[model samples]
Target: MSEKMKKIIKIAIIASLVSSAYSVRAQEDELSNDSHVTTSFVKRQVAQNMSIGRAVKSIVSNYPQEASAVVSTALDMYPDKYQEIIHAAISAQPMLTEDIVKIALEKNIASCANIVKTAINAEPSYVDFVVTAAANSTPEELNEIVRVAVITEPDSADFIVQSLAQQHPNKIVDILSSAIEAVPLVGEYVVETLLAIFPNDAESVVSTAVRESASERANVKRIIETAQNFGLDEESIYKYAKEGGATDEEITAALSEATEQR
Candidate 1:
């Protein structure tokens, strides 16, 4: 097997071996001392497709502390098991990831890139994880995140714009607006990203707003109008739409209007 597959398997094994002991206090060298910080703890478990999700869920429930190691080892040992772990990440409550994911986000994109590449290879469907990790990353790190996120999940224009607005507001607005204009179908995501900019609309409009407002303003308006449009809603729109009285038709019409604005 390839080296990447080997790492994932190791992590899956660790997930299988985890116990519910109140505490595991051992030396850094020996997991018996610290369950959250060792390679051996990961080697003892067995995570099949059926159990992999649960195992991953358990580890992520303890995220950052669990770090990229669990998924890393799992991809190494059970390459086929990566997606199961990512799905668990998606559905598992209290979303979290290995500390290495954060360290990489905080310190260097290369570090995070290595881990995310493993995730992408093992679980191609979970490319969004890379996008998400980039989104949550610090400012200097965002551009690199955006570069990778777009390459990995090109369909996620909103993620790209959001990253630009959230991280490099000064240079990003016009650039992103141009991208949105070029790809009008998903222009709403750009506008949405604009809204997400701090100081709110002021930041968003500074980009392609006034210049493109006449032609693209409607599209831009739809996404920035509501606080939720800017991702500031009390609850996620997806969940709200599920529970709210608005019908699918209503939402679709709204989206259509937004898309047709420019």
Candidate 2:
């Protein structure tokens, strides 16, 4: 309550702030010189102000070279803020989207879909980069990643699916199925896209669609008809339709429609 005590408390607060500023400045200087200052600086920022996104953006924008380490440290400090951390990091250093995604996914692979979503949503122009980076980092979640990527940016479905298919040729069926299942309306375009990329894998693409329809989610009728229109033989179409559990009636209707189109 005394004026002297109040003045002394005010001085103490000012001193504390000045010391903090100098400490931060020292760390900032070290960050610019050495990439290793990422952890301490990130921890201090998050501790002082729980703004993970702003903290990440500040460090990355100022020290682009240390973007990877800064992002890795931020994610480790606030795993739940993966979305904010990723968005800010990529926004600050768009060129380092790959490294940012790799770091986030490496820290929380379970958030693979969400991490990819956030990165792509933050930098829509970097959709391809975001996807490939995520795929490369967590190929095990390729299907989920593809699904979320397509859902996030359906317009880029073809390119997104094609890129992943090329990266994991063995997962062609899974990739196509996931893409179509995500945006069924794009099924026709997706099938056409993959067929264009993997011309030799037309049979696989068509069959996967047919099988996907078995779940009653994908449209087997449209897929078969599309394959038939794509110049696939009726016998192969019929075989795959049967194998995919397409009811005889559905197969008949699909094939008949294709024949009518021809």
Candidate 3:
């Protein structure tokens, strides 16, 4: 072939190859965009049609960290189905409960307390996480949470109280007082835990329990016994108890009983 014809043929071949490569690239980009849009639409439909339980299972099955965000959003959108969704999600993926609770608290979700309470109630074993999360809440909110926890799960009261007390020693008296008030039966356990952790604050703890729990005679007796067992002097116990509103008759009877025991 002539040189010019040969060169023309080679140029045409190169041009054709370049055009084919551009067409393939354009097609790939279009396909990529279509795939993304289709995936997103499917996800939305799945979310809308599936039950919250299935939605949660699907999300947490792969994206565990997104559990809280998903739950929080679900709660905002479905106020009426609050408990149902929460229970369903937690029931489906128990491990995600902690993440759900932590995110709820971090975001200051209004129903954080109820969520924690429900989570703990459903699985008492999560009490530690629930209590820890509640510790970050306002004092009043924390108090209410503690009250509900102690009242509902009295057995978990000791652990809950101890965790909060250790975290906020200054609030020990108030926390214990609330716990004792809710379930006076927990008073003895509270006293024992308090004295073990805050021996120096024993007087304050006893006085608060006595003053606040005077109506609860059994609780008062438990406090007095706990104080005595901790080696607090009889006079100091009586004086604090008196200052805490123990009746003269109640103090005398308690001290007399203590002496007999000694």
* lDDT to native, each model: 0.48, 0.81, 0.71
TM-score of each: 0.41, 0.72, 0.70
Task: Estimate the TM-score for candidate 2.
Answer: 0.72
Measured over all alpha carbons after superposition, the RMSD of each candidate to the real structure, in angstroms, is 15.1, 7.2, 11.1
Off by over 4 Å in 2: 1-28, 43-50, 214-262
Which candidate number would show the highest lDDT if scored against the true structure? 2
Q: Which ten-residue region of model 1 has the weakest summed lDDT? A: 20-29
Which scores higher on lDDT, 2 or 3? Answer: 2
TM-score, predicted candidate 3 vs. hidden true structure: 0.70
lDDT of 2 by residue, 31-57 (tens): 866566556767777767678898888
Q: Give the candidate number with the greatest TM-score.
A: 2
- Candidate 1 local lDDT, 6-113, one digit each (tens): 999998877766742323323223432343434445544343324756766665555544545565555555555555654455445323433334434443323444
Which ten-residue region of model 2 has the weakest summed lDDT?
A: 209-218
